[model samples]
Target: MDIVPLLDRIGEPQAAALFGLITGLIFGIAAQRSSFCLRASVVEFAHGRLGSRMAVWLLAFSTAVVWTQMAELSGMMRAEDARMMAVPGSISGAVVGGLLFGAGMVMARGCSGRLLVLAATGNMRSVVSGLVFAVVAQMALQGWLAPVRNWIAGLWITPGGTNFNLLTSLHLPQQSGFVIGLAFALAALWLARKNRVSLRVLFTASGVGFAVAAGWVLTYSLSQVAFDPVQVESATFTGPSANTLMFFLTSSPVLEFDIGLVPGVFLGAFLSAAWGRELKLQGFEGAGSMSRALIGAAFMGMGGMLAGGCAIGAGVTGGSIFVGTAWLALFCMWIGGMATSWLLDQRGAVAQPGLHVPH
Candidate 1:
């Protein structure tokens, strides 16, 4: 009984697709249950309520950082293999793109990953945003926006002219970087809990964070078993989102479903939602709201393309590794988000303007 042959028969692409579907479902269900939203987290923080979502994001970052570094140290992966750490990296592009992405997320009310989860949970606005995000991301990746992004990327200056993580660039070792980064994360968690931390908030945040970290560990590590030549990497959402959309379109050419992290997130979310009886279909109320979602999606696509990652990619995964570009992107994303939120507030776009009619 050669089970290895049977497993191999299933193939990689199919595994990836199945992974994506499962990932989407898990992401949808968890997000729906905990109200896990990146935009909402930032908004709440901005408004002085930061005990729940922010903690979860921080915990996820901390867990990913520790796990990724351990993977590197254990010969399972290499930091240099990540796209954000590549030579000739686009520093300017990351900042500019992050700003745009941040702004767009605010306008659209969620990041691309968040939008997918929301869509699965019957948020029609999110579905519109996800569709728009996919279309514009594809366009930006291979259409009119490509040249512009390239031009901006060309302006980056690596003064030291070396390929190194931020810690190394500052004359620190990998171990020191790990320790310092972990310390910072712990400090943030401490501060978040310093003033009236609730156990519910802590549990939800920690659980979600662990789930996200587990997601990366499982998919990347498992995939590497089949593709032994490649290094395993984890905890990215943007490029995968765009790639999944393309895969959906070009399914005829590639017919294998490989279980990847994003797909796992979807599956996990979906199952979680189904178990809780929360799955439903919903649509946008009107053209105006739909238009806003579309615009937000386009911005997210363009910005994520330029920046080379999204909230999860740059903000948590790479950022935790102390990747300089990731930090730049994260800062710009925060700024862009804050700016967009302010603009939206100015326009009084807080509440749904009309009645909620079922679709």
Candidate 2:
């Protein structure tokens, strides 16, 4: 029958966290196996090569879009109840925040999700960067930097913001939206047809897509629990990272789904790295490198808060749901990342080409 009611009748919050953990584990394992870094994908695409990584990202996005829509149409979920609903769409915020986040990912060498995975695999640089990311994200979301974020947001909020997708704007039936989303997914996969994709990429992409969809479904289900309040969301890292950090530092006994998801990713990645023999102890070069990482992470934290999502949160998860803010942020992040990548190349300071375990 309806598992949502069943789950609510049993253990509510813990069950939600368990679902998030499962999703996070799948996402982590896939990311580790495929080396699915968005920055890396951007760099590969910039080189005029159709990268499977990018394709995987698109696949994940399209899959989530279709699944989420289907769920909504089936009366399983309502996207309007998501956390992003209250946040007014700010194109300026999306563009500037995305640009900053993209540039930061270049310097940090991974988005928030990737950093979580890397940190679990003994990458000290990622550990440091993750900490900075969490702390700064916390600040921007609800701490001292909140005023700055509010001020920026107050400057350029869009009026009459539509639901983050074309389906809603088209005023079409949900089935019509599903068809369109399915077509978009197929098109994205077809465009990546030329790329020499591997089984790992396919598996990783599917896992990521499922994880995103699962987040929506799980959170939506939890929202129906009469006693406990849960927001409808999916696998986003920015606010989750901050929330996770806050959980440990505060006296709250309740654990949200994201807290479990974040740690589960780390655990899965750690195990995957150990299995793959990719795990290694590594750190930044010196004070200069550390300084750069801190600054970059700071940018990501602030940008992620303003844009309302990070790479995975906005790019993949939000994109899956076809949120306009996410789409715009993803575009700006790409531009900002590409510009930074090009600049670093010109300065002869770009990291060595090809992915590898931290040294």
Candidate 3:
């Protein structure tokens, strides 16, 4: 938490990168160990079942919400300064983009963060899809698609351009997030009990949330002490994947949080998979599956850029802090995911994961 000394030793950018590495490491290990995936959870929901997958996800989501709220309440972090709050956002983008991202994740059979983690574990299908995702994300961010993203996002700006906190917008109590998080935690516990989820899995899932909190505290702490300004942010994959890609392609690369975060996650996942004996080379089932994954990746790349976040980004990170756009996006994601899952089921493919991995 005390980052001034670290800043003095390595300066601001390096310090921030260090924090991102640490955060990503924790998230990767936890996510891999716990088998956490929003796609899996959505699959369960689509079938009208609350299984271990649902339990793990709810625990992670609630944990992030609780810890993030507590940090802000205790004055350990200024959540308000985070770009999710301070910057103008897009309502139109959230609705449209969330739907696309939700459907894309179903087809891809994983979210952006999930793809990266699986790729680190030697999932070849994920590797190809992830690469496609990063490239498309780069295009969306600054290449041929920028104008489209900007135009769509410009459709509906945040009320007054920035005064749209979810809690404030809804006139809810100040501590509503904490209260709701506690409720969700209790529900998660009950579901875990019913689903027979083990304590080890739950603990690992909690680490996923802890990483979100650590990301916030670390970056905010650095901003207060660093000589140059640093943006306060937490974990997300779409933008960072695109940014890391650019870092590698550029003549001159800079070390920053996004750069550190991606490789840290890869290292963490590789180590975790090796330790767990879960490392295996898996590829797409056929051309059809490969096409599905690639198409899904493209949709996610575009949607994540337009929405300003992916599942982990908006659904967990921004949702924890009660961002209005984030919650709306998260809600729409569930709807999109469920609807896509149902359509796939009707088609008899269920957009079945290109290759099989243990649940």
Best by lDDT: 3
What's the lDDT for residue 245 in model 2? 92
lDDT per prediction? 0.65, 0.80, 0.88
Task: Give per-residue CA lDDT, model 1, range 281-305, as digits (tens).
Answer: 8777678767777888889998988
lDDT of 2 by residue, 171-246 (tens): 8665875786688778767756767677666667667777777788878777776366777888889998998998
Predicted candidate 3 versus true structure: per-residue lDDT over 1-359, tens digit per residue: 67677677887778878888999999999999998899999989888899999999999999999999999888878778887888988998999889999999999999999999999999999999999889998998899999999999889988675727777777887789799999999999899999999999999998899999888888888888777778889999989999899988999988888888888888888999999999999999999899999999998999888788999999999988888888888888888889988887766653454533222
> Clashing pairs in model 3?
none
Q: What's the TM-score of every candidate structure?
A: 0.80, 0.88, 0.96
Candidate 3 deviation (Cα RMSD) = 3.1
Q: On a 0 to 100 scale, what is the lDDT of residue 255 in model 3?
A: 80
Q: Which one wins by lDDT: 1 or 2?
A: 2
Instruction: Rank candidates, TM-score, best first.
Output: 3, 2, 1
lDDT score, residue 298, model 2? 90
TM-score (C-alpha) between model 1 and the true structure: 0.80
Model 1 gets an lDDT of 0.65
